[model samples]
Target chain A: MRAAGGDGHPGPVIELNGLTKRHGGKVAVDDVSFTASPGRVTGFLGPNGAGKSSTLRVLLGLDVPDAGTALVGGRPYRKLRNPLRTVGSLLDGGGAHGSRSGRAHLTWLAVSNGIPRSRVEEVLDLVGLADVAGRRVSTYSLGTGRRLGLAAALLGDPEVLVLDEPVNGLDPEGIRWIRRFLRAYAAEGRTVLLSSHLMGETAGTADDLVVIDAGRVVARGTVPEVVGGHASLEDAFFALTEERGR
Target chain B: MSAVAAEWRKLLSLPSALVAIGLTLVAMPALGTSTARRLAAQLDAGGDGVLGTVTTLTVGFELVPFAVLGPVVLGVVIIGSEYTRGSKDSGGGRQITTSLTAVPGRGRLLLAKAVVLAGVSAALAVVVIPATIWLAQTALGEHGHTWDALGPRVAGAVVYWMLMPLIALAVTVVTRSGIVPMVFFVVNSSFVSVTHLLTRVTPLAAYLPDMAGTRMFTAQGPVHGGLVMLAWTAGLLAVAALVFTRRDA
Candidate 1:
């Protein structure tokens, strides 16, 4: 079994302790625990319905956990003085209203969180959406939508970022842009927790890996550490799941 | 400033806001012109009691444009837009609990929504009142009515239109849909008509958001008067605030 212990590192940027979530009587996430720290992109790897979304939702406080606590900067999300500034998140590309222009949508969110209106334009440029920033979101392609989501996430200049399936519909150019942006964002001493079902997309992107299956943590370690005995990140992920018979 | 700013953006950004305002501007003039024409035709027929008929017709006609559709639709948009836009939790389905985990103080966010709705209501009043009044006066003159008698009627319509949107704003927040508030406004208006039909019931129907707001179109005394209608506006808003806090959104 993969080692079940902390990395002997400083306090993690995000800490989950025995986190569990249940919908009705079905357990979506079993007792799970892991830590995401600063200065690296910690990829939260899981297959569809593997509790990745649930875990992120729990982390962001979108859903309450049946047990355990999800913390950010050593405190719960709702208690933060300015949440958008502390932990920027991109949960779903289609979360925004289609009728609203990209800038209008972001501007409202910015205003709500006390972020300056000018930052709306800034993030749009950062995500390469400046050209179509005034276009209504309904006309955007999936890649454009992803860019808009990323722009909103960056609007706060947050200390920590939690992204779910961020690169799902991105083009090669957009993908390359995100890879570089995420790395640079982390290099600046910020915490980045990204979730993706595709191992290939994250293979070259993530420094640390946390693999989950059947709503449980199957493996957690740096990519090299976990892939020590495997050929690739995919192989390591499958080996862990097969070993657990899940 | 924060509240006003937040509310203003929300009201303006909403698709329903435009529809609501459009309905008011278009419907008022159409109805006003039609009433004026109908009255002028009656006077041309040299009907007895034409002056009294013209005076009463203008006030009664205001209901179709302002009292009924105006207030009900505005109420629905104010609160329903949030739900229609799927803005219940932070970032739409991000889960407010999660949002709370991130920002805490979920209450403040909701309060901001309320502030936006309130400001929009006032702005709607400031803009629509004068325009509606001018239209009503010009239309009545075309119907063989002098401007002197139509002035108070036009002013009343303006006041009623202004107050109606606020009430609708509150109703929508509480009900979370335009359909429910629209149904309530329409049903209540029908009830007022029913009361009048059942007994010498004062035109109390005019005092409900739709009925009473008609008085603004023409200074006819609604059943419960302006105080009662103002109470309705305040009460609906209060309920909206309460529902906003209690609900999951």
Candidate 2:
């Protein structure tokens, strides 16, 4: 089994500092700032269009911010040499061509970052996708595709992981497996930042929470601190976001 | 170097690239042989038209231009596949996300892809050009010129093939889809030769990429034509790299 951080190096922190992004003329992420520290699962909680994805996109360098900085390990993602060795990301769907098999998809990604080909099979197995690795992605069900995306994210066994809506399409068992896997991952002193609209699931998995409404942070802290007298994280989430929505 | 290997594998793994290869291999030689046979038959019937001047090199030249479609399609597929969306059940993701995450330097990634596209196009030309010429010569039999006559013309054809795909790749990068470049190239190369027709309307039309590229093998000034085509390829590629690096994935 690969140890967390792969080579025994500690996980790196993900930091977004006053990051602002505009799509057309409207603000998509407005002066957003947060940190997902090493050795913790930071749940980025928001409603749909809450700018959670926009923040993550800037963090990964998939989209440019109009102002401010998003950094991983104290450097921008685009500046990292062999970035997959430092960070792994899951966005949207499988992030694979429909005509490519799951194995083929991982194979090219591995090759690109100079990751060993052996890791391809390892990730496939880790995600319980070894059986269908040869099947084209277009044929995969929603949950299966999510597994493939997770497998790609895990291919490098990197120090940090940034995932968007990771449990959105998962079944109950898959959700349970991911919760356990992520918790154990952070337990090994690695960093994980996952975005979700599902309050209960994030509450169960995240050690810290950063809640955004529209394009700004509404609340951020440990679950207990953010929940503060709200009875539950779910109730806290609704109250925080609903208050901002008004 | 690793990025190049990855891009190469990405291209080869696409079923559309393989299909394009298969069709090019078949179509080039088939077209060469048929053209050669028709010319020979016309010569035998004592009909002097273009057939009266037919030679082995000319027969190959007649068919080689059409082979441009092969590289054009391959070039478009190289970038088009990245933007292709998956089925709704698969979350409608695009491979560009995975690609950017793997190699976050957008300029580096686009350069690697262009290198692979150029290499594949050149390799395809090396294989298909010789095969088509050999088959055409065999079909021409006694009427054909010796293979020695093809030395420079064959080189010219290879260069022409190599450059055409880069042009296609650049256009596809800007458009972010294969449909426009594929239709524009395929129709102009095969159907009516829009560039060829445009030559009658203006002298400057002779300088258009495809029209100038064709002159590399078919005209006397191979160097001049090749340079013009190269300029077009380089300019478009520069614009594409700029747009690609500056745009969001």
Best model per lDDT: 2
Residue A36 displacement in candidate 2 (angstroms): 0.5
Clashes by residue pair, model 2: none
Candidate 2 Cα errors over 4 Å, as ranges: A1-12, B47-56
Off-target runs (Cα >4 Å) in candidate 1 are A4-11, B1-4, B40-61, B64-75, B78-105, B130-249
lDDT of 1 by residue, B148-237 (tens): 865566555545555666776676766656677677566655454542343345554444555455555556574345566778877876
Choose the strongest candidate by DockQ: 2
The Cα error of candidate 2 at residue A163, in Å, is 0.7
What DockQ does model 2 achieve? 0.81
User: Going through the candidates in order, what is the number of backbone clashes in each?
Assistant: 22, 0
lDDT of 1 by residue, A1-246 (tens): 477433765668998999999978989899989888888889999899999988988787666788999999899876677688889888853456666788887887776678889899899888889999888876788788778888878888999999998887788888888889999998998899999998988888888888889899888888887777889888888888888875
What local distance difference test score does each model get?
0.69, 0.87
The interface RMSD value for candidate 2 stands at 0.7
Residue B165's lDDT in candidate 2:
85
Task: For candidate 2, write residues B18-127 as lDDT tens digits.
Answer: 99988998889888889888877776676455554555468878777788888889999999888888888778888898899898888889899989988998898988
> In model 1, what lDDT does residue A193 have?
94
